[model samples]
Target: MKTLILTTAALALSAGAALAESHAQTVRLGTEGAYPPYNFLNDAGEVDGFEREVGDELCARAELTCEWVTNDWDSIIPNLVSGNYDTILAGMSITDERDEVIDFTQNYYPPAASAYAAPSEDVDLTGGVVSAQATTIQAGHVADSGAALLEFATPDEAVAAVRNGEADAIFADKDFLVPIVEASGGELVFVGDDVPLGGGLGVGLRESDGALRDTLDAAIQSMKDDGSLNELIVKWFGEDAQTFE
Candidate 1:
């Protein structure tokens, strides 16, 4: 009698957990609300920017209820794996190393170039001390290129290294650096060739979450087919920014 009672309780708990998961169909879309043009907190202190626009449209088209979630870049992937959020819609590039740990939706934004930025046009890139956001592809690139790689927790801090003369230059996304260089009024300038990195930007998901991945993949394909993806990229990063077909 006790064995039967225990089995029934187990079944009840399994059903309850399943019910909770179904109720959780209200997806949580995670992003680092610090990368501007891609994502950032607006003056209203709420998540805003390009990925925000894209994610909202995706949820609407997929007919899924989703809420925006802000997380730091370093912990972003691990949190998705741990179920803190259902998806990561940050401007994360699709790469093999990342793919080994998580599945990705099809590319929404094409691969962007990484470039060096400095206070002057004549900064040494190959052998100079350079800064990049910690744990990013740019950081790896700088480390591999014989440049002294100084990494920071955030993009702003990486740029601050160059501004404060702690580093000779900073390497980051061209689209990101272009705005800063222009806004710097000659305070900062681009140096060296623009290096293309990664495959392209895609939505990050847990490897076991196949159903959720399919839903978002379909939504991305729909956006690409309708030209809306290209429109959004151009809207945020300008006409020169990489866009999907």
Candidate 2:
């Protein structure tokens, strides 16, 4: 979905050990409170979405006290490395570039495709301007798609860029774009074929937090084994959403 930078490699290593030792305390869960159906701010201003539900359940299964902390998508990874939070459960896709900076639990959400949304199907996807949230795989894809890439700080802004004619189309997760397109009442429509990206969405952790990563991975595996994880995916993403076998 999105990418981020990291620092404090030396500190990240030690932080994991300390976090592992202090597992009984509240394990801070980091998330970008912007993406919907993944992680977003609820009406009460609390983190709420598919990831939140899955994260809460994982914490319960792991017997860990966890709390959600919101952060900007661009800084989510750097903050984790700097110990701002212990884990990132914000629908971050697992990619090779990201793995070099941080650790990820086995995917809680399966890989999904990215798609384009435009005011019309005639928008030139290959030769015209495209909008995407900065630091996201979508933006990266846009940069390489022979289209002019317009980067925005947030997904909403990126979509706005398209609606306001600042760009020809917006590229993002199909899951994220579905409701927006449907709610647009014909103002927006899906354009082009869906582009599959990344391994899947997993819990991101500091590179040093191997123990915490392993623990979370175990919890995720348990959910998958018993089918509760599939239930949660279906509950949040609808009947057509992907589920574990």
Candidate 3:
């Protein structure tokens, strides 16, 4: 998982506090439509990807009407709190610090490893200008790795920095980076060990939305038991991705 950082945002939002809501009739799944395999907009300019498929299935299993909402990653949680969406299915990782601001259903995607990519394998991954999407766990990791962290608003921007020689390498989820490296055709190569981060990816909910949490959690559990979730993981991320039994 090595997603964006969590330690910073929890201080601003309280997780697990008492609040009330009527039973949900419809739920909005919020996502950052930029991260591929996990999530990305399709050629039709619509929400389309693994999470979209999974979210739609979860909605069907829960007997709730679900709609997709695209949001900037940095403000996703805030918008959820503001009621712009009912649930966050944006490839968010479950973690202690984030759990302080919002509740998470059980993980759908198992913990994934993060990695670095550069124009050459000889690139210095531990130092120099390393790029990462801001607020991602990779960025935090880079900050602590003694590298000069060059953060971008989106993952594409971070990767672009590496391509443009603005950065020595780009650090991000290996699952997310694998395709980029494969398609680079010698333009880029894997540069370092893969680092596992985050507990796993899950649907996020406000602390008060226990009922909705239960509904989505049950749907996820059912999918896991029947191997549907694993099937989806394979379809989107290839069989090499971490998946539940």
Instruction: Give the top-scoring candidate (TM-score).
Output: 2
Which regions of candidate 2 are displaced past 4 Å? 1-22
Model 3's TM-score against the true structure: 0.89
TM-score of each: 0.89, 0.91, 0.89
Local distance difference test, candidate 3? 0.83
lDDT (C-alpha, whole model) for all candidates: 0.85, 0.87, 0.83
- What is candidate 2's TM-score against the reference? 0.91
Give a tens-digit lDDT track for model 1, residues 126-196.
78899999888999999999988999999999999999999999999887788899999899988988999
What is the full ranking by lDDT, best candidate first?
Answer: 2, 1, 3
Which one wins on lDDT? 2
lDDT by residue (tens digit), candidate 2, 1-245: 11111223223434444555675578999999999989999899999999999999877666677899999998889999999989998879999999999999889889999999999999999999999999888899999999999999899999999899999999999999999999999999999899999999999998876778767776777677668999998999999998877
Q: Tens digits of per-residue lDDT for model 3 on 115-170?
A: 99999888877768899998877888899999999999899999999999999999
Residue pairs with clashing backbones, model 2: none
Residue-level error in angstroms, candidate 1, position 65? 0.6
